[model samples]
Target: MIAQQAIGLIAISALASACAPELYKRDGIHPAHIQKRQHIPNVVEDTRGWTFDQSEEWNTQSPGWGACFAGTQQSPIDLQTSWGFAKSSPPVFNYPKALKGPLNNWDFGPQFTLAAVADDNTTEASIQFSHDGVEETAYFRSWHTHAPAEHTIDGYAPRAELHYVHYDDAGIPRAVVGFFVDQATAENPSSGSAFYKQLESLALPDIFNNQTIPEITLDLNLAISEVNDYKNFWTYKGSLTTPPCLEGLRWFVSKDIIYLSDAQLESLLKVSTFGARPVHRVWGHQVNA
Candidate 1:
């Protein structure tokens, strides 16, 4: 059955490409009233060099992210623990504590990408939260990671950063919840984030191309528990922190630090050693760390 399904999907993908290129873009994306991404260059085959390490050269080398050097409200800012107002009403996440069976995991060369591909829907997962005057539900369209993290805590960067990218109903990026992971001590080696473990296992092979794992079960709630602490988190307005540097994104940087063992960290580094963007300057931005 699995083989038949895979064959059917390949056939459908081929037919879709051969029949109508306008219906679905050549990159397998369905067109809609999405944000202006035409400025962003194609990255399907250019993953090897266009990484976070070379983000500084994105302007001259990778012209796709020239705005990254010019944008003011960029992301992955250093969370100043002493800043921002402490509100009583914190954000919440309505995610499953555990997933039933296997879920699809994709290897987009530079990093692992996961979404609800089986359903043919744009959103793979989603969660809800309300803070300040902002009451919005975010759908999980896709997720990727940054080794050595993006946002810093009081000037300290974590071992790795898990970015759960969410979008609104209008197909605009609404929020990105960043979970910071630190190296675990001997006393506490496991942080109970099965999602991270699954990602590590799937990406440990380090095949730099388009690949997919059809079935991988994980505890979505445990993953959230690994990072989500209802009381301790920082929220701010920022950009995607990547190419094009599109602004107007909502950022939720978790204050609670999750722990990853040495082996797990090693697995992550093996997959994408240079997938972290340099820390961009943050000036006049609001952050409650």
Candidate 2:
């Protein structure tokens, strides 16, 4: 059944390309095309040789950043304390009940959804879905933290926002996904790939300068197409990627790196400075490649 579903998805992707060349691409559906990426190593390596003149403290404090700086078991590094584990287990639901609407009917389970945006100058991305019937939203934004240090994700350039999961009325997470944008190539508007083109269509204009671009919404189908293979993700329990730094949460990040044009990335930086948080501690969590 899963095999059939995969085949069907591929067919649908092909059809989408014919229907909307600007929205979907023929090459965006392949698992091999979307390669896994390394954030920590990429930043530390600095193959681009970008300059970093800001003080360690200033850089760390820059607009958006955070991680497990206290050396907790957390994988990324700048988080605070561990909530330990929940003693009382969450409710469990039967298969029949699970299929119902608004996951709230179920006891506990993980759900997935896709989001994307694109237009003239910017591309915005996010995932919106209901978990346990509770609806929540997670979008990309520039994030940063102090403890660790100053660093940036290449291609993505300056920063990218990783909106932590949002909770439903029941206090359950509705979604968990990260947002990222990188420099687009001149040859291509963004990645010159079908996936990037899909997002460009929904691009939003800048607020300050109507002529300038701000951020645009990413197409859900295109975004999912970019990361179809889930095997290469890093999974762990941690806190929200934003302030208030809530702890005790599950995080799954794909090792796969998505690309955009440099010009597209520069447009985003114009509106927001840094968008990523520092690496938090691994917290004894096994990082599966």
Candidate 3:
């Protein structure tokens, strides 16, 4: 059955390329929007890089950027429950009671920077699991955010999304666990408010404006507990959503949504800009739950 589905998807994907190139422009994403990124302490981003709305054609900056469009396993694909089999095991989180600095990463959103110093070479937090019979461990690196979310589930797009980036013992990119963010309405309240408290603490725009860095801490352990029931996720092999989109990434997107109040949701949106890449093809990759 899986083989037959693979053949069918391949046939569909092949036919998709014959269509006209579809372009999705970035909304209100300009480098000057947040002037002088990484100019402050604990705020970090690639000092020299490209923007989502630079000159329109990103490929002009580098020929390698073509990979962003041409890759077979590019990410942020709309996921469906019927696409994958049961996962072999769930990934484990090893967050400390108190993880340090909300390092302002203008490039991939704010990261909960645990590495105290630039020269530090130690594992701060990690996630361990076995996939395809191979046991692997990835360490926590950054916490990223995107407006209007990224990947959709069964064609339903959420308000926003968050990414927990992890790496190997040597700081190599490993796996990412993503959760969709939903707004709290009078009819539907937030289930993860306890965890949203941490976000409330980080509701400051100074995190992005290169102003005085404030002391912030994260309680991810509490977050995991609140999301215990929603632990179910879909796993797949994909790539980064940004330019020069790299492949071979392990992706786990939560089946549940993280709800936030109007004020809290607005706080996040205040700092976020729309540079989210368009949803790409899933190709023949299998998604696991």
Select the stronger candidate by lDDT from 1 and 3: 3
What's the TM for model 2? 0.40
> Lowest lDDT 10-mer window, candidate 2?
101-110
Better model by TM-score: candidate 1 vs candidate 3: 3
Deviation (Å) of 210 in candidate 2: 13
Give per-residue CA lDDT, model 3, range 1-289, as digits (tens). Answer: 9999998986544332211111111234356644433332223222235555452355565565565666777778898867663445568778897886644534334445455446432456888876566888887765667777889878878888877766665434567778888898777776446666776755454334543234577776765665554357788887766644656668888776777878777777776676455676677445772
Candidate order by decreasing lDDT: 3, 1, 2
> Which prediction has more favorable TM-score, 1 or 2?
1
Q: Which is superior by lDDT, 1 or 2? A: 1
What stretches of model 1 exceed 4 Å from their correct place? 1-49, 61-66, 84-88, 97-124, 186-194, 199-210
**Per-residue CA lDDT of candidate 1, range 1-289, in tens?**
9999998986554322221001111123323211222221111222223445566766675444556687777776877777753453454565554332222212222232333445342443567776346677776644556667878877898877877666666555677877887778776667545656666645443434323343445454555666545456778778776654666677777777778777776666666544456666775455552
**In model 1, what lDDT does residue 122 have?**
41
Model 1, 59: alpha-carbon shift in Å? 3.5
* Model 2 alpha-carbon drift over 4 Å, by segment: 1-169, 172-175, 179-181, 184-190, 193-218, 284-289
Model 3, residue 190: what's the lDDT? 68
| Cα RMSD, each candidate | 10.4, 19.7, 10.5
Instruction: Give me the displacement of residue 284 in model 3, in angstroms.
Output: 4.6
